[model samples]
Target: MAGGVSNEEVGGKLWIMWSQGVLVSVVQSTNQFITVNMTVNNRCVCISFVYAKCLQMDRRELWNSLSSGIVDSQPWIVVGDFNVIRNDQERRGGRPRPFSAMEAFNKFIDTAGLSELRFEGNQFSWCNNQQGSARRWARLDRTLTSVECITMFPEAYMQYLPRTTSDHAPILIKLEAESVSYGYPAFKFHQTWVTHDSFLDCVANAWEDGIADHGMARLARKLKKLKQILQIWNREVFGNTGQNIQHLEDRLSRLEIKLQEGNNDEDEQDYLVAKSELDLWQDREEIRLQQQAKQTWLKK
Candidate 1:
């Protein structure tokens, strides 16, 4: 164990621990975050435990420091109580979050190149143990990863385990994918995958490489070939669009932060361009989700 709340301590402390067999080293351990660098199979991965400050400025500082702590190319995963939420949906029965604060938090994630891991179970990770109007809930706890890490562990997922004797839910991240424990993989398409850069190209190429056949036989052959092509594309080219978008957004956020640090015209221009691209990509993702939701609704 790295650290924990002192018996007499009032506030929380960051703690981190790992199983044996992996080479682990402490990169840094502070009140806000703990960075643990681990190596397995000749690959390096950094895991961070974060307990962010509630104040806006302090939170920004945490993000800045945390972002700088890990290398850009290194596979990093951060899990903890951020004391912040990404969108309004993550919060309930609380005063509306300040737009500036939410934007800054999003920018921090974007700057840090962190993508939220899709979670199962509880959507809200924290709840204020209060009655009536005082009762509020927010997803204060979450797991985020760098794009490199997401690519490294594409099957990684978080399960919000039952909360007991604590306001925050205990989240369990399954690093080892379900596919490993279970045999026979089932193929299902994700709506977000279409937002990927090479999605259309991949589909087009797969469709182009078809054999000459007739009627139902030709359709069956093409569909089978397409499935194989898509599986390969999903594994290699597509990967995860959510992570890809997060990475791009992070790059944009970094550029914006640089603009704030200095009066650099080049950086300002870069930020604008990046922001435009991010918006476009976001629109595509929204459209994909909308289409998928419509299809699902129609089916029901």
Candidate 2:
């Protein structure tokens, strides 16, 4: 661990990539590439290193290795500096990455699809290791993923951290808890009532034919009806949460008193039943909160 940085470099300064705990190296890298195995979240994730080389090496071998190296179980996030920039914004000094690199990157993206994790933050990862006017930068560092990983943690994102010690920026990524989904439908008490078939039918039946102002009047009337229905629905749904919460508090209080006395017959059975009831109430209360969140979404 290079001064507590937890570094494991392979293949000298020419390259470094870690997958799981296993390290791979190519010491005499005139080609300047290496591959390593690192595990994330108790799963094997592989990284294959490719460097800026003039040689016309086909990436098929490296790509094949990356896709095939691990046992077919864990989700994979293969990433690092490949000396490749995916788009024009990634290049500084207005010069773009080579077409070959972009082509290879698109190929990789096509292989992975929308299941890949979002690579957030400013695109540039490495700057020209020179000083003054000749200096430049490019997006090189990256984190990629397999389909399973994207689904497992949809909020996972990568961002470029400012460089301090090295010319290359550190890639910072955070794993999103499995539960959050960006567009998961929130309960919209308002919208739900507006969209209800019975309400819509009532609105439609109120309109008469052959009147020019009838259209606008009917539309306004329908909206008002929708709003009224939603208000009623919200009161009906969320209004009971207070009752459920109060019931839970009362049960917990009684149970705690029984446990404190430390004396009665049927204590074990009574405690278990009380505990189960408390848990059930808690679950119901949580559902109420989620329902309120849905209502908030609807209001928006």
Candidate 3:
């Protein structure tokens, strides 16, 4: 892809990394008034003008178009100048944070379920070459991914390095994936089971039974061991059981307290919100528990 293409340029380019024996397919091109789409892995990729006075591709429109026009289902990589900074921290010393822009971009990327390639080295790329107390700068380049591409090619990442000619540093990205899992003391209960009086009583009884015949010192030791075992059991059972009825109960209780906090329901809207959340929580717990049981089995 060339550096001076118009905001509306679009085309394809192949990257041959002989060292890794990989041929990366990148289609570099732009659409109607939209920045061009770059290619890699035979997918729609791009170099967008995010901060221009008049954006060639409005964030929403660009994403919607690309999303609807997905090419072959091969791994994809879209890397180039986004122009928009992701966070306030990107600037040397700017306002606290630009949340609106961050949120807008986030919604667009998340809508596409884009996965950011974690590039090592420098986090920022663009810089103002001047040094006195007056030089200005920005981090304008970035690499993005489609949810599908991340799964197909997990080894992908971006590398930001010094640019000899332009103020903006060049970006290098590698694509790949690695599998992993963590080992921890597994507990036997779910969050829903956490606030259960019966569950608490059962655990308390188990601890008491373990120390019934011991002195204070011995009792404490025995209780500690019992706690560990109980926690492990909980991890084994309810660890992955995502929120359920009990969680909804908490939400409802909190909402009710809020709505009734100063004597009044703001409106039917508040009531409906609370009611809907409550309903989902109520009917979801059993199904959640069953699914949790399956996860527990698989983990074990």
Candidate 4:
């Protein structure tokens, strides 16, 4: 909860709630941000409640302030309304966001060694309920934490709660008692992976690389070998599906901007190319979401 919830909680004098084994205390507070320090089971977790400004510079300043407060070797979690998105896919139907604007936020996350705590539920945490050109949905609210936090409470995960009256969704960060072991994520093929130019080549190479007796056993071995190849291909070529979409969107935005500045034929051509690629990725995103939701109505 970023906008209304923060206001209501602060107004109702219920900003901080403490309980046994968990001690919550305010470390810093400003109109745009609040830092809460909590100690549970002798492990200290720093949570920053942020409400960043709309302007790029203001958001960058907020990031700067946040990065400054992080202590080395301590568990930290930052949550709440960031107001700015790190990528184009985070928002839909609004004016494309510039790469430079997100640079500061990305840099801060990198420098602070923070990772996004991928949550379950809606992809977007906020929405402007307008149709056509005015419609916009964005993942403005996010939960991010230090690597140490993930290492300590491996089972901990964040969830984006449904939005009620407020434009923002309340994020629930759950920390389980047992520590989870780190392991490789299961191999699952994404439709988006096929959009790349080298996709067919990569798959063919993986298929041809396998050698075994001709039967079901050989098929199983080939599939197992293919999974490993795809995993490596994903890291080197695809990266994160959502992030790849964002990067393509960012490139499209730049080309569009350049075209708008003057009648540059090359810029226009590049814009079209990027736009086409973005469309393909977006379609894959829709398919991925439908598969995840497992709605009968959405099934092909």
Residue-level lDDT of model 2, residues 1-300, one tens digit each, is 111111235333443534344434322222344444544456544444445433325454445444445435455566566566667776666465568767776676666442335775445667554433455666667777767666666777886654434677777777664465687554344333343346555445443323444577867766666555545654654444457555644554454344333435565456456556656555655665667777667997
- Models 1 onward score TM values of 0.55, 0.43, 0.42, 0.53
**After TM-score superposition, what is the CA distance of residue 153 in candidate 1 from its true location, in Å?**
1.0
By TM-score, how accurate is candidate 2? 0.43
What's the TM for model 1?
0.55
Residue runs of model 4 more than 4 Å from their true location after superposition: 1-21, 131-133, 177-300
Least lDDT summed over 10 consecutive residues: which range in candidate 3? Answer: 12-21
Model 3 residue 200 distance off true place after TM-score fit, in angstroms:
88
- Across 42-114, the per-residue lDDT of candidate 4 in tens digits comes to 8788888777778887787778788888888888888888887888877766588888987778888899899
The candidate that wins on lDDT is 1
Model 4's TM-score against the true structure: 0.53
- Between prediction 1 and prediction 3, which has the larger TM-score? 1
List, residue by residue over 1-300, the lDDT tens digit for candidate 3.
Answer: 123333333422222222222233333334422334444455543333232222524555555555554555544455566556677766653344457666666676766566677875445566554432333446677777766667766667777653334677677666545467779744444446655456776577776664545578887787677777667665555443344434543453453334322324353356456557556444446655776778867996
Total backbone collisions for each predicted model: 1, 6, 35, 0
Off by over 4 Å in 3: 1-28, 31-60, 71-74, 94-98, 176-300
Can you give the lDDT of residue 291 in candidate 2? 71
